[model samples]
Target: MRIVLDGISRQMVDRKVKAGQVLAVPGPSGRRIYPTFQFAADGSLLPGLPAVLAALPTRDPWAVLNFLVNPDARLGGRTAVDLLRDGRVDEVVRAARHLDDQGA
Candidate 1:
């Protein structure tokens, strides 16, 4: 099944992602955006995100936020859009394995 993300959610996810950022499936739809931190893994906002997000203003809406979103970016990582377009678990898994091998 495909996951749906709103514009704000898309923006947040996009910001969290970098061209070479480490990627881990975490699980199906782990890319979700939660409205509150209570539902997050640590019951706190994703590190180093709110500051930037706050500056942008919360005009967009998103859901099912994952805890894995990284703040310290390492540009050039895979993204949900990339994976969704690929449509191959093996390729994704292999790419992830490679990233793991690279110490992602």
Candidate 2:
């Protein structure tokens, strides 16, 4: 992640994670591992990711990650991350708001 972020300080990365601007899942050794899919090629957070994160019903990192990557019928069978990548932020946010409505 440091390499991908162009060597930004670890503190900065941690701050981003703490601020809910980035996604970091737990690694096997209990270290935070940032998922590359959450970042654009330029190492910035994917557009509208922060808003989607805020809209998600849960704050658990694993559940949030699963919601982002897993297929959802609410999204017409497309993953939230894919829709976000395609600039369909509103649709994803709407789906997220109703994640539990249909037991997603």
lDDT of each: 0.32, 0.85
Task: List where candidate 2 sits over 4 angstroms from the true fold.
Answer: 1-3, 6-8
Over 1-104, each residue of candidate 1 has an lDDT whose tens digit, in order, gives 32222323645555544421212133446654333321224333333233323222222333112212322122235442233234433443333323324444
Give me candidate 1's TM-score against the actual structure.
0.23
Q: Lowest-lDDT window of 10 residues in candidate 1?
A: 63-72
Measured on C-alpha atoms, candidate 1 has an lDDT of 0.32
For candidate 2, what's the RMSD? 1.8
Top TM-score model: 2
Q: Write the per-residue lDDT of candidate 2 for residues 1-104, one digit (tens) a residue.
A: 25365457778888878888788999988888888888777777788998988888888999999999999888999999999999999999998887667565
Candidate 1 regions with alpha-carbon error over 4 angstroms: 1-40, 62-74, 78-104
TM-score of predicted model 2? 0.88
RMSD of each: 15.0, 1.8
